[model samples]
Target: METETRDITITDIRKLLDEVTDPEIPVISIHDLGVLRDVRKEGDTFVITITPTYSGCPAMDMITLNIHGKLRAHHIPHFKVETQLAPAWTTDWMTDEGKRKLKEFGITPPMGSKGSEDLINRHPPCPFCNSENTELVSAFGSTACKALFRCRDCSEPFDYFKCH
Candidate 1:
């Protein structure tokens, strides 16, 4: 016996996928993080395109699994998740809401767009005290995409989402 496929619109599927949050950062959704690229239907199959924040990002594997779980939970059977590497992902793709969420989550968001000259000299403000008197503790933070920073004012250590 064949099962009937539900006639769900692309918008609906996108909304569902938007519910999937980043495994590392639970406060932000994949869509907000700029990882989720596109959602479209190709014939009878639904295609979900995603781009990693960087090449060989380990989160991609867990993200794919989460996307699969979300779609499956919604009874979306005929779907395919594709990873696109060209036109590499950048912090510029991050949504304003996503950035705000990151700050609220105690992680400083990317200060400027990718390759911005101002970004070269500017330092990420401390999310705790909103102070510019922050020093880089390490080039790498909890994740490869972030850098560790310590705010002198607040005496707190936070992760800055590095621009790429």
Candidate 2:
């Protein structure tokens, strides 16, 4: 008897997912956000794990569709994407690399320790100038995903991912 092998690998999934940029920030990928939890082969298909940036984030739909669409285009047959919120995704989960990409894309990423209590703290330095002279303009930004803020030193408005 002969056994069948699969070409669907995590690398393939990651590569395909690399094509999935955050809808809000096209330069940064969802994987960069620490969103792509796990990609592994399971039987004849693949299994992907993801965590939502927030509980009510509407982008979840787009994310799922993106995974399916891209993988399907690559001729990937069957797969399952499991969403886990146990360690609910937070801005703090955003990696250093992700931050750099955000800055390069003209969007200021969130500052230190993303926690509910921490969001109200006024001491986070401006990601643009590394200055402590920044103020929160509003509690919301482009989407429920972010907040509006202005840097006192740079005098520029920026978005801060709501650390939910």
Candidate 3:
């Protein structure tokens, strides 16, 4: 029988990744938003795969740094951050816990696509009032990934997770 030693470990690094948060929206972890794809050991280094919420969303730089910082603290010295664009990051990939956290953070969760059309046709519920009487204030919110919404019942403005 022969003994083998693995120089790199991934499970621990992946666990520490939860500490990294979106710089713009601290309440959401990059992982929770479905941005983080995978972390694997590649020889003496690490391969981190991430998908951006949108093609040109500006939060990517900070997201990368946050992940790296967390990884480095966990002793993952050599790592590569790779961007994976397809099958692309979709609102559908958002987890139940992620949705609940978003609502608790005052952002509504996105519903599934209503049709074959590429546009986001489903109206998101208001996080504050949970009212369906919500209207789109604008398709673009403070961030390109989110839509601006107003709750008719509560007369409060909120960000809708509905996005293409």
Q: How close is candidate 1 to the true structure, as a TM-score?
A: 0.92
lDDT string, candidate 3, 44-96, tens digits: 66788999887788899888878777766666667889998987788777778
At residue 21, what lDDT does model 2 achieve? 75
Candidate 1 lDDT over 45-155, as tens digits, reads 889999999675799999999999988887886899999987889899999999999999999999767863333345689998899998888877898788888888989
Write one digit per residue (lDDT tens) for candidate 2, span 1-164. Answer: 22233644678678889899777677788888878878878778688888988667788878888888887777776788888877777777777888899877656677657667445556456667877787888887888777777888989787766654
Which is the better candidate, 2 or 3, if ranked by TM-score?
A: 3
What is candidate 3's TM-score against the reference? 0.86
Better of 1 and 3 by TM-score: 1
Worst 10 residues of 2 by lDDT: 1-10
Model 1, total clashes: 0
The residue ranges of model 2 lying beyond 4 angstroms of the native Cα positions read 1-5, 118-120, 127-130
State the weakest 10-residue window (summed lDDT) of model 1: 115-124
Candidate 3 Cα errors over 4 Å, as ranges: 1-8, 114-122
Global lDDT of each candidate:
0.87, 0.75, 0.76
